[model samples]
Target: MPQTLKTLGPKAAADLDGDLMSDAGGFSIDQLMELAGLSVSQAVYNVHPPSAGNNGGDGLVAARHLYFYGYTPVVYYPKPTKKPIYDGLVKQLNNLHIRFDNETPFDKLAGESDLIVDALFGFSFQPPVREPFDQAIAVMEKGVKPVLAVDTPSSWHVEDGPQNEGLGSKYMPDYLISLTAAKPNVGHFKGKKHFIGGRFLGEDVAKKYNLNIPEYKGLDQIVEVPVDVKVEKL
Candidate 1:
């Protein structure tokens, strides 16, 4: 049988996420987020343990780990969340001198970089996008640069894919790093590659929610889920 992974809608995803971060879950939010970021970095490097390593912004975490993996990443964090987690992630990037071109135009960014990791809007983003981010998504839709989204593409709904049957619906990343488990919207993910990563989901969590996630081989933090496999509700 082909390898299978369960797909969760946003509500289920949110609930499961809460459980993973709860005292009963025995996971610190930062710790789990670190694993998530590491998993994403590993996926980007396309290697397992003993090979390459391990986000806050999710993008921030990915950027830091990618730097450790020997990739020169230039970031575009126009508006940053003021949370301590984000600050800490930024500090790590600053120590490494990872470029954060908040002033550079999106089209220019598209041309200058090899890959655009779209962490502009994470899983919680609602459609009819606000300020600069709206412009960012627009540029990605039209640009030629390859994109690797951290979770859902900027304006896409967690369960329904794109909010508008407009540009967002048309835009797809070159790669998508599905955190923890694949979200239902991934069925609409028209990216060139899809990867599932994250190491904090316990057997209890999965069993309670009936999440049929993949088993990470050995010490690997990520697993390549062949995009051809059909996605179904859990």
Candidate 2:
């Protein structure tokens, strides 16, 4: 029998926010970030188990997860002084004794990576990409390595998806690992694979938001989302 797929519009997807970072429940941001990072690491390992290169917000956390699982990961980021977030991320990396290089250029790092994690931006990023990140994203987009985007693809509009349709192929990710819930921008995801992680949302919250998300059967903390399916009401 043919499987009946499920789909959610961008708006509905956006409304489904279960990220532990959000005040949706009692979980701390750090706790949620850890879970989110672990999910991403496992997804990448499942498909492409090799040394990785990561950039952006969740990249550092993801990198740490990879290291814990005995994978080699090279993280690229602006100096901690450039972004306040990097300050804590760097400390965490140092504390865990994970390998990273914030000074090397993206082009040079791109060559070393077997897979790239586009954690350069989250669901909150607005377009135009700005400065160093813009250049870095361009380099990664042009690279031959497959990319797994964390949350949303870098440089893509959160609500509208990729702004430049012409460059869609260039910037599109091979895989997307959405945390908590799928973001609206994921409706624009051109990836071959999409997975939902951060399965900690309570039933009440899910109902209040009308998330309409499916259950993660068995011991799965992450589940694949089929494309072009009919919407199923939760």
Residue 96: error of model 1 in Å? 1.5
Q: What is candidate 1's lDDT per residue for 1-234, written digit by digit as tens?
A: 245557877788888888887889877778877887788777767633223211112288878888877777777788888999889989989999988887777777777666677777767767877787876788778757667788678888887887557657678777888888888888887666788888777788888887765767898887777776788777
In angstroms, how far off is 151's CA in candidate 1? 1.8
Q: How high a TM-score does candidate 1 get? A: 0.89
Tens digits of per-residue lDDT for model 2, 1-234: 114333334455445433433575677656766677777887787667644333322377778877767677777776344565657877888888666676777777777767788887766676677777766677757756678888778888765678664333367778888776666666666668888777676787666665544577776667887744442322
Looking at model 2, residue 202 earns an lDDT score of: 76
Clashes in predicted model 2: 2
| lDDT of candidate 1 at residue 97, scale 0 to 100 | 91
Clashes of each: 3, 2
Using lDDT as the measure, the top candidate is 1
Q: Best candidate, TM-score-wise? A: 1
Query: For model 2, what is the error of residue 117's alpha carbon versus the real structure, in angstroms, after optimal superposition?
Result: 0.7
Root-mean-square deviation per candidate: 3.5, 4.2
Candidate 1: deviation at residue 58, Å?
A: 7.4
Write down the lDDT of every candidate, Cα atoms only: 0.75, 0.67
